[model samples]
Target: MAPENSNTEEVVVGEEVGRVRLITLNRPRQLNVISSQVVSLVAGFLEKWEKDDDAHLIIIKAVGRAFSAGGDLKMFYAGKTDDSCLEVVYRMYWLCYHIHTYKKTAVALVNGIAMGGGAAMAVPLKFTVVTEKTIFAVPEATIGLHTDCSFSYILPRLPGHLGEYLALTGARLNGKEMIAIGLATHFVPSEKLDELEKRLVSLNSGDEVAIKAVIEEFSLEVQPDEESIVHKLSIINKCFGEESVEEIIKSFEAEASREGNAWIASVLKGLKRSSPTGLKITLRSIREGRKQTLSECLKKEFRLTMNQLRSVISGDVYEGIRALNIDKDNSPKWNPASLNEVSSEKVDRVFQPFEAELELNIPPEGDAYRWSGKYENSVYPTLKGKQ
Candidate 1:
């Protein structure tokens, strides 16, 4: 292991126990943020294990209250135009691509907060386990950043307008909700995770059935929290499912005025607090993502991310990073000031394809969606309106 400093061990640790190869994120103090060192270690381990004849399965876990908070925002805070930060972004995209097309049976035991880049790591795995302690979100838009790490490909596939709702509002979902939303394969209490890991490590076969059977032995049925926003499916679809952000907010306001619903009021507050430009671009990203392949989405997202970092049109990303992280002010002066100030032309520019050298490259096998439909029935049916 390469030691970067006296205080920090290698941020990622790889170990072989029986037939299973274990990859653990080791940075707990910083909430296991993805730094360049972590990326290098993960890439190395994945490469070595892929070629190892004895490795039958790959399991990823973390040692912290957060699986990972996201990419190291501090890196970008230095300057988005910094070449070093750009390199990390490119490496992160490749890592997401690798996880999607991994040859081994990939399982992730996700506990605690998994947002943005962390969710990217967990969501594409062949099997993902979560505990009640797990909380997941894609809050990029809230920080004036669009979602990346192949989320463009994954989010649009979620039921109804849930994906759009999440991208726009940065909603959080607990572990049970993760399974309900098809983001995780199994649910086990946090206390049982150790026992589950032992059982998983004992499995010697590559047969998916055997692997699933082992996982199921530790899995249990879990109900979402009583106050889950997902319970408001009709309202969510009615508002978020609309054609445009302005239309959706107007619908919410109209419904709130008629019915006096507190939830709608709260959602409106969140929308108003977020960066207008971020919301407009995020909506466009998820909508266009509906028709794009994973590879195509990643390529498109790469361009968008580069532009976001460069702060070409608006410096909202820089302003956001300052307010949320560096300054800790909780106040951002979003350029253009309001949603009405953003134009479709500006959003279109963010989605434009990148030049040849800047585009993300994926392996031939990574071009297709490889999901096995295991969690297809997870989402509950949407409420039908009265005739």
Candidate 2:
């Protein structure tokens, strides 16, 4: 049913799909950039739908030009440097945490671009679908920020050194590329997307084997295109696996000098422009993520995100928001005063826990982690063919 009232929330709509309940992202105008309002709407709906006996399966998708342009930068920009900023960030983190452990067969339809915080919405589902036009990326570094939410959990699980490359460089990919990297399960042509979705829903609508067979049909035939980024896996692992951010930068510099490659040149420039705090923390996050369990990584991310909020107002984050969103100025004066000055101590702080209690703002009523320790080993799966 179409919206009939002005009372619809900017972020969501709740409707029935046969016995399934579909929670759709509704902010088409903003490309569904998330805010606290959006977060609350999603969390609230999922929480409710999880309990609804009528909901046979959950279908999560977005309606927009781009599935989501990411967390609303304009809203984040408006609240920058204030306590409200931390509160907003906290709320978002809480939302992702809720969705991550949700027990149902939640699916994300990547009907368009999925990047940054928007990428957060797609990667945690039971299965994620991408249309031919779907473009995926994590361009957080370009705007002087780190990838937050539980992205750190999913990215490392992707096929190879691709996660590291994608995180640092903010390279975008189409649906076929996402499928290649194990980031997406199915790729349907945009015109055939609706029909494909109905078929998927049908297989899973009742019979388990039928569902598995349909999944196998999609999963069975993965095409190995000659032009895939698989060849660059060697370069990505070597550069991203260096000792520190400085070493990584040095590696990129060396690569650009030797190869004179356009990609390396862009990476070097992107590294220079990224938030120092974001870069250091990301390096640490990915490194720590290798050994960290899903629960540990989520807790660690919360710990890190909380600290990033309270350390100081007008901190590196401020300069990040200012340069990227406020002034429209690509130039940001990253503190520690200098690249050399951004010490190990400063980097350490991002990993350190915040003061006082470790209270999560979102109530832990039905968190999937609260139920079982099944997935709770300290170490996660490692990337194959990459050290």
Candidate 3:
């Protein structure tokens, strides 16, 4: 329970209803951004509910038009000069891991905009219910940060080279596209969400089958629209499959010249507008993610995040935030200015393992930490394994 206040300023609100434990992101004005406070509250609720015998299911939803816009970049910007911000990143990633390995079933009702940390919270759950109003993206690279919040593990597991494409380009995926790509488990119309919630609470059981059955009743068979970038899988696979960021841009450039595709041109422009160093680092992170376990990927991402924030290689993140958020200039002056100038050595240094004490300490996965989503089985195949 939150402390009583005249303002009722709770960023997150939680309650136990029947057999269901519901967590709501309450800070609509802030887009329910994942501040340190938000992380602490949500993590505490999840930990508490996991131990509650009366709690059979967990449902996470948010008020307003955005599920979460991402972590508080302004907060990050404020703490950029010191290690003060790293604690939040550490705790947030830990929360992400806990959700991934949670014992009981959890569902995210992402009925609005879900980006970065928002998408992080939803996608890893046992079931992610998206609606027509849902808009999802991992646009971190544009801000000179890598896609994170266990996305390193989740994204690489997406079908074809879709993971790389999304990570590199910060592409947006609609509800139908999310379902098609296995990022979402169900698509329920926005209007039925309330009824669906009521039905779920009535179940009062964590039985995956029972819960899934109820959800399926309202779930629609949705396909990505004809104009969805999801349909460009073949081209996405070919272009993003290249060994390097340079190669990827080159491939897109070649494709654009040959086909004169507006989409391809847009991709190329996005690449050109992003920090060269960010593109390189993000590309490597997603590639490494393919071979690493979820735990390993989180650790590596922790390192990358720390290094980026600390400006081990460059201060592109700061510049990016300044240009986009603070200054609203929409023009960032990347240190290396171009992809060719971002050396392999600098990128490697960013990924180097942190000191044992500095590393993220993730708990070992329990048997209950398994994924059974309809699309995940085919897209992810296995969650365990080093190779």
For candidate 2, which ten residues in a row score worst on lDDT? 374-383
Looking at model 3, the pairs that clash are none
- Cα lDDT of model 1 by residue, 142-203, tens digit: 88888778888898898888888888888889989989889999998888888787787777
Task: State which candidate has the highest lDDT.
Answer: 3
Residue 367 error, candidate 1, Å: 12
Model 2, position 281: C-alpha lDDT score: 72
lDDT of 3 by residue, 305-370 (tens): 989998999999999999999999898999989888999998989999976645677765554433
After TM-score superposition, the amount by which residue 277's alpha carbon in candidate 2 deviates from its true location, in angstroms, is 2.5
Per-residue alpha-carbon lDDT of candidate 2 for residues 1-387, written as tens digits (9 for 90 to 100): 233332445568766656666677888877878877787677777777777666666777777668887877776656544445555565566667667777666777788978877877787776777876688888775555665677777777775556666777677787777777777777656666555556656644633455445544544344535645555677777887787778888886787777535567766777787776677777678777777766566667766665555443116665666777779777888765445766777777667664334434334454444422211121112211221
lDDT of 3 at 188: 99
Clashing pairs in 1: none
Native-to-model Cα distance after best TM-score fit, residue 75 in candidate 2, in Å = 2.1
Top TM-score prediction, candidate number = 3
Error of 2 at 189 (Å): 1.0
**Each model's Cα RMSD:** 9.5, 7.5, 7.2
